[model samples]
Target: MDRAEFLNRLEAQLLDVPQAEREEALQYYEDYLNDAGDAGDFDILQELGTPEEVADSIRNGLRQDSSAAGERSGQADEN
Candidate 1:
C-alpha cells in the first residue's frame, strides 16, 4: 500500500491507544516514511510491513521496555 493508505490504516488501528502514545507512534512512522521518501524510496511500506504489524511490533517493544524498567526499579528498591 501507499503512504496515505498505510498511515490511514495505522491511525485507525491506533484509535484505542492513548492520545499521547498514539501521536508519538504516528510521528515516528511519519518521519520514518518521510525520510525514506526523501531518500528516493517511495515504496517503504513493503520494507516496513503493514501498519497493523508495525503497531504490534511497537506495542511489544513498549511492553518489553516497561517490564524491564519495572524489574530494574524493583531491584533498586532492594538496595
Candidate 2:
C-alpha cells in the first residue's frame, strides 16, 4: 500500500496504544522506509514483512525490553 494508506491503517490498528508510543512507533517505521529508500532498497518492504507483522514484532521487542529493564530495576533495588 501507499504511504498514506499504510499510515492510516497503522494508526487505526494502534488506537489502543498511548498516543506518544503510537507516534514513536509510526516514526520508526517512517524512518525505516526513508532509510530503505535512500539505500535503493524498495524491496525491503517485501522482506520486512506485512505492516501488522512488523507492528507485532515491534510490540514484542518493546515488551521484552521493558521486562528486562524491570528485572534490572528489581536487581538494583535488592542491592
Candidate 3:
C-alpha cells in the first residue's frame, strides 16, 4: 500500500495509545516515509513491516519504557 493508506491504517490501530504518543509516532513515520521516498531505494513497508506489526512493536516499546520508568521511580523512593 501507499504512504497515506499505511499511515491511516497505523493511526487506526494506535487508538489505545495516548493522543500525544500516537501523534508523535505518526509524525515520525510520515517523516521516515518522506526521507525514504527521497532515497528512492527503500521499501518502507518491507523494512518496517505491516501497520499491525508496527503498532505491536510500538506498544511493546511503550510497555518497556513504562516499566523502566516505574523501576526508576521505585528506586528513587527507596533513596
Provide the overall lDDT of each model, using Cα atoms, as 2-decimal numbers. Answer: 0.83, 0.75, 0.91
Q: Report the lDDT tens digits of candidate 3 across residue range 13-61.
A: 9999999999999999999888888444247677898999999999999
For model 1, residues 7-53, the per-residue Cα lDDT tens digits are: 88998887877788889999988888887765544557777888899
Ranking by TM-score: 3, 1, 2
Writing each residue's lDDT as its tens digit, candidate 2 over 1-79 gives 6655666777777777678888998998778777767454447666766677777776777789899999999999999
Judged by lDDT, which candidate is best? 3
RMSD of each: 1.9, 2.4, 1.6
Relative to the true structure, candidate 3 reaches a TM of: 0.92
State which candidate has the highest TM-score. Answer: 3
Model 2 stretches astray by more than 4 angstroms:
38-42
List TM-score per model, in order.
Answer: 0.84, 0.76, 0.92
Give the lowest summed-lDDT range of ten residues in model 1: 37-46
| Candidate 3 local Cα displacement, residue 68, angstroms | 0.3
Q: In candidate 3, which residue ranges exceed 4 Å CA deviation?
A: 38-42
